[model samples]
Target: MNRRDVLAAGLLLPAILGADTGQERSTFRIGLTPVFLDDQVEFLKRWRQYLERRLEAPVQFVQRASYREVTELVLHGELDVAWLCGYPYALNADRLRLLAVPLVEGRPLYRSYILVWDEDLTSRSLTDLEGRIFAFSDPLSNSGHLFPQYVLSMLDLRPEEFFRRTFFTWSHRHVVEAVAVGLAQAGAVDGFVWEMLNRLHPEITRRTRVIERSPEFAFPPLVTSIHLAPDRYALLARVFLGMHADAQGRDLLTELGLSGFAKGDRSDYDEILFMAEELQRA
Candidate 1:
């Protein structure tokens, strides 16, 4: 109901949904980070169908409201593969292997956007929004929470000390809705999600304006437990890298607003790793 309640419920969600408990699974499990799931349920269904056919294996979708739950599943081996933001991937870099990275506008980079009500021209910057109720998408999200917190740290301020109150909406769309409908005075959300929403739901997006944008960083990537077999990993990588060339896969990518997938390595996320370190120090 409130920020504390929302956080408590989010922490308990995996258990509430009877999430997998580090058990070995036979099916090819693909866990979504839950950013796009709430917005594109039908598109996800179609994408899953394409993956199932290409992988030639039974695929199951594992999801949770917050990235934390799904990250835990991937770390514990409950999920064979997962789509996670750069922040979480860097947080558990030792335990996860890069699978593929989405190419947005033919580049494996995206930004974090600070959003405020469109008519509120008075608050054009982060400092201007001090003491305002702010919404973050998720604690483990790069665009939603980490980058904004980093911004505050740079200002020599902590979130609790800067904002009147801050809350996690658990999803980027919720962050958009909260600011759009005036539940929150300002919010931080993924730039990609914000743009997609602007295109798909202008009625709601019309109410918000981007007050600031963080520098570009590596996009969220598909990942797997480090223990996944090398051969299986190769197969999965091949499928993703070739998706843009395959007719069915290309169509799915179009529906998903993706250019294609590119092979990603640890070096691609060095900036995110640095941000993680900075946040820890803050």
Candidate 2:
């Protein structure tokens, strides 16, 4: 199908493709959140079909509106695997096994971008926007929420006290939208999402400009519950790690703005964990 046709099909296919029919006991379920996937319905359908073909098992992509919901489902073993933010993964590490991390520009690292409207040339840093409205993607998001919060904490200021008002846009794209349209004076968003949107939807990104970029942190990762069978987990990991080697898989990765997947090290998230720990103490 052409891109337009695929996008249309994606909007209409969720009920038919993503719902649990209660018939496939062997289905390998993977969870997602708008933090990454956003509205790429066609991409999800294509990736699901690719995974089903590779694993020789039925594959299902379960999507939730927020990272907290996806993380809770994965922790309760309701989902076989999930693409999760580094903060949530660190918060529940003992119950999850790192499955794979996506490579962005060939590195498994990304940053948090603090943004302002393109016309707002005077605001160069977060302090410049103090007492102005702010947008946060999700409470559990590392780059969107934690990193921004950590910045405030380091300055000995609290979000409620620093900003006149703050709100959650629930997704990184919306955070950008909130800032671009003047709904918020500033927003914290995932750098990967911002870059991807700049590539695919520049009209929206052109209205906003990134003012600050945080230190590199491990990118969001795909994780499986520790309760999963060893063989099943290995199979899932192998399929992901081998994506770049296969033509069709490589195409899917490109469409998804990824370089492929790596059997990522758990230690990669230590910085996120340390930030979380420090926040708890504060």
Candidate 3:
């Protein structure tokens, strides 16, 4: 069968099994971008458990070492749901639909942070970091790559010409550790990830300083393929949006460093789309 046919069949499996079976017949698949995986293995485990128990269905976690890989899986309907970076979601708006966005610092907004070593007082701003080695989380990441690139463009500087060298660490925690361990003179990271690291890995964060913070932008969001049945997507949405209200669910969110999940509209990501356009224009 083609992708659309497969997706239709997957969504109907539960009903096709009929109610007499007394067992859930469908597996709910969730894709995760690599950005949050390295430091969040335990959290992911707990999250999977919470989802499975809450939905009373088998839950599987699909992940890759690249954001683009996971994003493509969701876009092509290989995954029923995915937690994706705003950049990819905005780029694939037609193929993907937002489910919910995690609330950080009590808001559905986060920023890109430029970080340097704690003792690196020589760099007070983005301009001061010229000719220094830098790390980015992922090429398709909003906070880790796009936003930082946008900032440089705003300064009329291209990343290649502004930095001595740069690399992608694939995970935000790795970006924090790169700067903290002096592997990179500076790095761009997800502010939410930085905050989580500050609490979980103080040894790494204590040595890092925020050199710059991009203005508030849309948070990364959970999304699903537009091909999925509306009821299937709506069921997933109800679980997330109501997670903070249940005891077990609340614990899971706390472990994930999220306040809760809120229904997110596509328009919530317009700023990111605008930034992407600006980056291409410059």
TM-score to true structure, per model = 0.89, 0.91, 0.89
Kindly give the number of clashing pairs for every candidate. 0, 0, 0
Candidate 2 C-alpha lDDT tens digits along 43-105: 888999999989999999888899999999998989989999999999889989999999987
Residues 1-282, candidate 3, lDDT per residue (tens digit)?
999999999778867876534333377889886554565777888888889887778789988888899998988888999999999999999989899999975799998999999999878887899899999999999999998888789889998999999999999989998999999999999998898888877988999999888899889999999998887888899899999998988887887788899988899899899999998887
Location of the lowest summed lDDT over 10 successive residues in candidate 3: 17-26
Q: Report lDDT (Cα) of residue 18, candidate 1.
A: 92
Model 1 Cα lDDT, one tens digit per residue, 239-265? 999999988988888766799999888
Q: Candidate 2 at residue 194, lDDT?
A: 95
Model 3: residue 172 alpha-carbon error in angstroms? 0.6
Best model per lDDT: 2
Deviation from native of the Cα of residue 116 in model 3, angstroms:
0.8
CA-lDDT, candidates in order: 0.87, 0.91, 0.88
Task: Give the higher-lDDT candidate: 2 or 3.
Answer: 2
Report how far off residue 149 is in candidate 1 (Å): 0.7
